[model samples]
Target: MTSHADQPNVARTLTGQSGGEIPRDDWSAGRGRLFLLLVAPSVLLLVLLNAYPVFYAALQSVRNGTLISPGEFVGLSNFAKVLQSPDFWHSVRFTAIFTVSGVAGSWLIGMALALLLRAGVYGGGTVKVLLLLPWVVPIVVSSMAWNWLVATPDSPMPTLARMLGFETPLFLADPLLAAITVCVFKVWCSFPFMMLIMSAALSGIDRSVYEAASIDGATGWQRLRYITLPLTARTTYISWILMTIFCVNDFPTIYLLTAGGPIDATTSLIVLAYRLVFQNFQTGPGVAIALMMTAAMVVVSLILFRQIRKSGGPA
Candidate 1:
């Protein structure tokens, strides 16, 4: 019904090539520009706040500096000194123990709680809120409460030990006991986060899959092993990576609980770095330690990221 000239114009309009509407290519370009405009401020802020400090720290790591002034350039000597220090190695060992215990213990407890909650236990909402209180409470307040419960021979834990006919256990005085206490405290404070993560991942799974497994005569443990775990593998790896970083970078947890004390038995790398920078005024070595920690974290993250990819990518 249309004439030849009119048909061409109509076709152009349909394809968004007419003067009244933007062409597809132009529209795409415009959208991209708008996205960049919206994201530019956040990008700039990240570069300023995170990137700049990391760059500055990298430079400082190569120089023998202090809080007062940037001292002589020392190349990698600071790193070498840190690596050779017995105290540094001691802290590294303790950090390894702390991180492993925190991650594994919290994950196990959280998974169990998540499964229990998923079963629609009575008063689940209230129970979940109660479980979350440890994480929700201010760390400072929690630390103080823990300190009061274990800091002295007259403390509640020690009193309980006495009543049980055992010697007064020095929870924060003995090096080994202090280390154990800190690691356990880290687990207590962190498990709620893992619970929330695992809960969400479990919720995403299809209920029909479990029903089918049960119909096929699969046991509860078998279904969990084969179906629940595999389906949540991506989320599990992500949580591990996040918790690893959190454990590595955690400063206040150990500091407030033990102050790296009795003999620095609970000192993590972050605590060691703090001592080096502020207490010892060895800025270069401190920053070098931090950089080494960052490198190690990157390696761990990449390994877990590969696991996530194997588990069908991110959740």
Candidate 2:
């Protein structure tokens, strides 16, 4: 429908050449300005939400005192004290145990479930949705449900244990049992996330590779060990790193369940920080502990980022 006279303008626009009806440089400048205007508010909000508290916390960490007095700039004494504390080390040990156990348990279960589903289990869609229910539920609600199931003497778990002839059924009262219980709870809530990721990774893998391997006389176990795990190794590592951070920073689950009870057996660093600041009124040490945890997380995140890049994951 274009006439010969109007063809030049249409051709220029189609080729991204803006000189016919608009100057090319001016159009580009306008687009750049529009992009900046649209993005600036979000950038500003992100800085305020994330950076400001970090700076404030850093400043607070150096000052010694209760929250009100904030005594004086102690020049890392707070951090030194925290590092030297037996209680801090105890919490650190438990935190490591909790994080490792949770990450490993969740990942294993998730991968297993993924494999089962990948093999085309009956009712796979329904099962997948059911598995995610725990995760979708509020943490407080989930913690309370778990508490009801195990914490009390007349609880179903204890009642079942008593009926089964076990004398002591205080699952949350014993130190080792408490630690295990928390780890199990963490796995229960976390496995769905891992399953979703592993499933996606498995799906992306070309089935033809497995077909080829099988044609070459690869058995079921052999294909799994050689093909599946290797192909999904990067995703598995990513899941581990992510779940490690989640377990490390998790507070609500432990707090609502145990409150670090039974001699501080389930106390993670986050719980310890909360206790120091709010319960003990030691703001300086609390902030220092938090900052130390932040530093540790940063180190772990950097390692993970490097690995992700090496594995060709998104930046």
Candidate 3:
């Protein structure tokens, strides 16, 4: 007499059933339907919210139009005009500089702060809250405060410069100084975000790994360079991608601080697009610039995403 364990399908055979388990094909089909059902609402929402605007913008980009009217289609002439414009190139240059500075400066400062905090410094919780104030404050309030700090010769920054026997630098007036100020401001506002992300990543690292490395005679710098950085690489890549997007798309920082300024000195692509659409009422060219920026952003995001996958392991 064989036991049931020796014949797992014995009950099904005795009961004249096909099998005790659902068919693989049927199970897969059922799961596929459930997946579709679960995601359908989100997909529909994305189509309505994101896809429609992008489609409308793509349509408007190739046409001569005002905000109120979709004028006749001109077939890439808007793109051509934007490409030929000197102001567009100027904006692109500033945007590149601003994005690079913001990403690098924020990451360096934030990572340093994160490492410092990881060492269990005194009153680190209080310090972290203080650090976050730059990011947590309303952007409008922050912008207003920054303007008061540097906008005039009578402002504190220029006043300090005068006290130091230096010619009062027109931070928002001079092209180069305005660009530097905007980039620095972006880094200041953004570093706290980077700090939070890095802090989380650092906390997830096992302390034992560092203890073992120390046993092997690894110095502090060596542990950081070899162990800490490698362990946090995926997070680093992700943070860089986010910060890059933030810096590239940041309009308010530059606009509020400088209004693209004394002679359009700090106009980023977004600012230029805004000036064209809202200020100049050139909808077609404005949308064209915006679409170009979107394309560039997509390309950059893809590149960084690939790096993230690489850092995380086999895709």
Candidate 4:
């Protein structure tokens, strides 16, 4: 549709010579305005909902005495108390175990499932749905269900143990056993999320790489080590970081199930904070403990994200 005179003009070309009117990019300003308009409410809401609470918590942590009717500001006294508490250290130790075990177990199982799904086994879709069901259920409901299955001697597992010539297992009764049970329960509930993310990472790998590795006589374990592991290293690290946060901050899984006991054996930092604030009515130390957890989370997340930046792809 161009005229012959216009066709000969260099300004009409994509290179934008000065012989004709240049196209205006007016949308850039409009887009910036629109973006701010759309994002402002969310930013405001985060400030109100998230940032305000954190700031308030920090303020509360420095204040002495109860939740309401604040006493004199005692800088770092609450944190010093929390740091010196034996119960706090116990909670921290168990929390570390629970986080490490739950993250490792879930990631290994999830990555295995992702690999199986990527290999396109029979009924993969159905299996994926079934695997997702545990995570899809409400935590309260799942925790209650697990309690029924394992918390009592009359439960199915204990009954089965009796039949197998073993004593009725007290999953939540003994300290060591309770720790193991809570960690396993957390893994069971958390693995489906890991599976979902790992599946996405697995799909992005080029099949040609694996084929070439196979032709070069790479064994199954070698391919897994040199190709799959290296490729998905970043994703694995990210998954571990997220799951650690979930496991550390978890309250319902421990409270609803064990209430941080078999004599306080399963108390995590979150549960300890709740017990201090609500049960013991020590708001200052409680908030200080919570802030400590937040600091730990920020440190861990930054380290993991740095690793991700260093890696080029899924790895």
Clashes counted in candidate 3 amount to: 0
Structural similarity to truth (TM-score) of each candidate: 0.94, 0.90, 0.91, 0.89
Per-residue lDDT tens digits of candidate 4, residues 118-194? Answer: 99989988999999998999999999899899888999888999999998899989998889899999889988999
Backbone clash tally (model 1): 0
Error of 4 at 90 (Å): 0.3
Query: Residue 266 deviation, candidate 4, in Å?
Result: 0.3
Highest lDDT among the candidates is held by which one? 1
Clashing residue pairs in candidate 4 are none
Kindly indicate the candidate among 1 and 2 with the higher TM-score. Answer: 1
Clashes of each: 0, 0, 0, 0
- How would you encode candidate 3's per-residue C-alpha lDDT over 54-120 as one tens digit per residue? 9999999998989999999999899999999999999999999999999999999999999999998
Q: Could you give the C-alpha RMSD of every candidate to the true structure, in order shown? A: 2.6, 3.5, 3.1, 3.8
Pairs of residues clashing in candidate 1: none
Please provide the root mean square deviation of candidate 2 (C-alpha atoms, Å).
Answer: 3.5
Candidate 1 lDDT over 1-315, as tens digits, reads 898878755655425445465555676788899999999999999889998999989989999989889898989999999999999999899999999999999999999999999999999999999999999999999999999999999999999999999999999999999999999999999999999999999999999999999999999999999999999999899999999999999999999999898788998999999999999999999999999999999999999999998888952
Q: Candidate 3, which segments miss by more than 4 Å at Cα?
A: 1-35
Candidate 2: deviation at residue 98, Å?
0.7
- Candidate lDDT values, in order: 0.93, 0.89, 0.91, 0.89
TM-score (C-alpha, index-matched) for candidate 3? 0.91
Q: Candidate 4 at residue 273, lDDT?
A: 96
Whole-model lDDT, candidate 1?
0.93
